[model samples]
Every structure is written in C-alpha cells, then in structure tokens.
Target: MAKNDGKVIAQNKKANHDYFIEETFEAGLVLQGTEIKSIRAGRVNLKDSFATIRQGEAYINNMHISPYEQGNRFNHEPTRARKLLLHRKQIDKLIGESKQAGYSIVPLKVYIKNGFAKVLIGLGKGKKKYDKREDLKQKQAKRDMDRAIKDR
Candidate 1:
C-alpha cells in the first residue's frame, strides 16, 4: 500500500460551512473493484456523506461512487454504505464524540493516498444560523480587503 500523498479526488465544500470542524481523521476506504475505478475517474461525490460508528466499526453513509462505465455486469452500487478502516482507538473516540449533542461525523473529502482510497472525516459541531451569517460576513470582509489592497 502506498502512503498518503494528498491527491484529493472529491470534497464536500459545504461541510465547512455547515459545521465547525473540531478534529479530522484520515481513514482508509474499503472499496469494491468498480468503486475504485470510478474514484480514479473523478466520479465521486462527498456531499451529504457522513460517517457513523456501528458495532465498533466506522461506516460512511451517502457517499456516491459512480459505477464504472466499462464494467457492465459487475458494476458497483453508486451510493452503497462503505466501511472505513480506522484503528480501534480512533473508532472509540469517534463514537464518544458523535454521541454528544449537536456533534456529527462528516466526510470532508475523498483522496487517493498512496495507492489506496481514503476519506478525510471530521468531528464537527453543527453551526447555528447566526454562526453561518457571521462566517459569511467575515468572508465578505476579507474579499473586500483583498480588493482594496489590489487597487492600491
């Protein structure tokens, strides 16, 4: 297996806007043959995907890995629940944090690290309406500042 080299395939941009990420963990994905092919083709979506600890294992829900085009008979399902490989200690930590109020395990991005498929999962707390507005305001301010600097 190759080590993680930070080649991102798909990312959920809304994950940062919707939650305040407290911590992130890199977990390996257990993908079927066609699934990995689809991922390499950049036909994957992390939007609306989340991870859950079930029976002491981590599984990602709603992750969409499009079926390989050339594989007719053996195509994998697009949105099947996929298992995430993590250490026992990490799984236990995720379970504890996810059980807390307003906290969740959300998939942030999917990337090829080494030769394997990996998912970057975040332990996040949901943002309030006000929090979202505040973020927007800050972003706008930063953009305005950059523009002003450029025009100077």
Candidate 2:
C-alpha cells in the first residue's frame, strides 16, 4: 500500500496561489459520523479553511463538509472547526513556526487514507501581489514553451 493511494476528497487550490508553502504535514481528523459520511461522498470543501495551533493542539477552521442528506437531526454543521490529531512534537514545531512573521498554517487538501480521513496542512508564507504576478508570468512562459515543443 503506497502513500497517496487513497482517494482525494477536496483541495484548496487558492492556498497554492496565495501562499508559498514552506513545509507540509499530514494530520488525522477528529470527525463525527455524519461528517465522515459526507467526506466519503466527496462533499468536502477545503476552500477558505485554515489550521491553527491553539493551547498546544491543532484545529482546522472554516472547513466545510456538507451534511449527509439522510442524517436528519444528526447532521453536522456545514462549516465547523474540527480538531486535528497530531503528535505533540509536530504541534509544537508548527506552533513555533507559525509565530514567525507572515507565516500561517493552511489546510492544503483532504483525503481518505486507509479508510481514515486525513488532511494535508502546510506552513506557508503569504505571497505579495508582485509575487503572484511573477508566478503567473513564469507559468505562462512554461506553458508557451511546452506548446512550442509539442508543435515541432
């Protein structure tokens, strides 16, 4: 069983465009029954979701997992702060790095690994306007080069 063999549930594409990810960590999620069902059904949104280290623990905020239609009164909230299960050392390291200027803990993606829901979190630095522009320019240049090569 190779890593990354599990199905990807959702991704935060905006995180890549808005932040320069310095380091990434995989953390388990503390999910409810309905939340797990919704995630398994691919009804998760990583957009605008971010992770924060609080009181020596990690919690993800703004993560939206749609309620299971059949859940009825047992349905979980669409957007709720969820706990992230991580080692104490990892949490401490994340806390130390996050306290630095312009650094943040952002949720990059979510997936099901070995029947367990997991999240990929990143230690990121916010990108400036010029940084984003430069990235776009470089991407365009790479695309043009690839097109030229394919045309030959």
Candidate 3:
C-alpha cells in the first residue's frame, strides 16, 4: 500500500473492538480546500465519528478536521458534519439495513488514498457485554497458543 502514495492518517480501533462489522464501504469525503489540507497534514480525528443516511444521502457526523494553520475566515468548521460521497444504490441499501434491528454506520478509518481523502465506513452491530468478554478470552487463548508454539 505504500507505493500508492496513500498514507493511513487515522484509525478508529475502538469501533472494531466494540462492534461486529458486517460490511464496509469506501467513501469520498466532500471537503473544503482547507479541510483537505488539514487532513493531509494528519490532523483528523475519527473517534466518536458516525455516519447516517439523511434525505437519501449519507453524512458523517462528529468527525473533527482541525483548522488549517494558514487558513483565514474561509476555514471549514472543526466539527461540522461532512457529506460522504457514495452511490445512490449503496445509500439506499445502507438505509434499509440500518433501519432493521441493531445496525449502525461507523467510521472505521481515514486515509489519504490516491491524493484524495477517503474514509472507510463500516456497517456493524453492537456487541453485548458477554460478547466483549468472550472476545477477550479468545484473544488471550490465541496469544497463549502462539507463545507455546514459539517456545517449542
């Protein structure tokens, strides 16, 4: 992935640890010039960021794009909601799935891909407390097995 001039700027590792992702989609962010510059400088935060389908379009909320240092009054708002560019069909599908049961759209990662700011959105279901405990046990068991094999 290095040769593509695409650097992963930020990742929401908590999303993965808390939810069972059912699907993922790559989305193009509609960003202002200053926002783009700030993102390229690795000043974006995905924590507490989530996506929602509104008026037949997907929007990302609560993602923070720090202001461009040299930007003046035209600088974009730091926590203003941003629109996500996704296909109409994809948006409809997301809306349908999200409305059913316990599904949600979460921002999984933000990266500069091919000179553009892109985000990976995940469709996920929240995990229960017991599920979280099970996940921890599984991780520990895997680590123990790996260590035992390495020492043999």
Candidate 4:
C-alpha cells in the first residue's frame, strides 16, 4: 500500500512576485496537534508570510493557520511565530546569508513530506519596480507564445 504524504495545505504566490529568489531550502515545521488538524482541513494561508533567523534558530512569521473549529481554548494562535527545524550548519548559512546586503529568507511554500510538515524557504532579494514590470512582460510574452503555438 502507498503511504499517505501530508498534502500541500497552501502556498504564497506573492512571495515570488515581490522577490527574486536566489536559492531555496526545505525545513520541518514544529506544529501542534490542533495546528496540524487545521492544516489538513485546508485552513492555512502563506500570504504575507516570511521567515527569520532569530537568536540562534529560525522561525516563521505572519503565516495564518486558522484555528481548529473543534478546538476551543486549545486552539493555537493564527499568527504566532512557528519554529523551523533545520540543521546547525544550515542555520548558520542562513544567518550569514541574511546578513549580507539585500538578502532575505522568505517562506515560499508549505507541504507535507512523509508524515511531517515541510516548508520551502527561499533566499531572496527584493525586486525593484522595473524588475517587476520586466517579469510581468516576460510572463505575458510567454503566454502569448503558448497561445500562438496552440492556435497553429
């Protein structure tokens, strides 16, 4: 029998539009029971979400995990900082890279791998207004090409 992989609860498309991702890494999330239940129900959002290396560890911020309907006072906070599990070497690399000029780490996507929740974090740099315009133009051009080919 095939094992069940934890499904992708949500993704942050805005993160890609606002930043030019340089690299990406996957990290495990430390989630509670209710939070996992909520995620399985498709009650999660990654919009406006980001990650930061604080003190000596990394944490995800601004991610909204809707409170479990069945959970009363045991519900987790929707916007609380969630710890990200990464190796020491990886954390060090992230910290150094983040301190470099114009570099940041943002949560790109969240999905289940095996039975654990995993987050795809990107090392990114903020995009200028002109860069965004250029990206938009490129996307439009690609779409037009696809349409022309389909019509042929």
lDDT for predicted candidate 2 compared with the true structure: 0.90
lDDT for model 1 comes to 0.90
Model 3: worst 10 consecutive residues (lDDT sum):
1-10
TM-score, cand. 2 vs. native? 0.96
Query: On residues 1-152, what C-alpha lDDT tens digit does candidate 3 reach at each position?
Result: 11223689999999988999988888899998799999988999999999998888899999999999999988889999899998887888899899988899999888888788988898999999899999999999999999999999
Candidate lDDT scores, in order, read 0.90, 0.90, 0.89, 0.87
Per-residue error (Å), model 2, residue 61: 0.4
- Pairs of colliding residues, candidate 4: none
Clashing pairs in 2: none
Candidate 1: stretches off by over 4 Å: 1-4
lDDT of 2 by residue, 77-121 (tens): 888899999888889989899999999999988999999999999
Instruction: For residues 51-85, write the lDDT of model 1, one tens digit per residue.
Output: 88888999999998888989989788899999999
Total clashing residue pairs per candidate?
A: 0, 0, 0, 0
Give the range where candidate 4 is weakest over 10 consecutive residues by summed lDDT.
1-10
Give lDDT: candidate 2, residue 55: 80
Better of 1 and 4 by lDDT: 1
Model 4 RMSD in Å is 3.6
TM-score of each: 0.96, 0.96, 0.92, 0.93
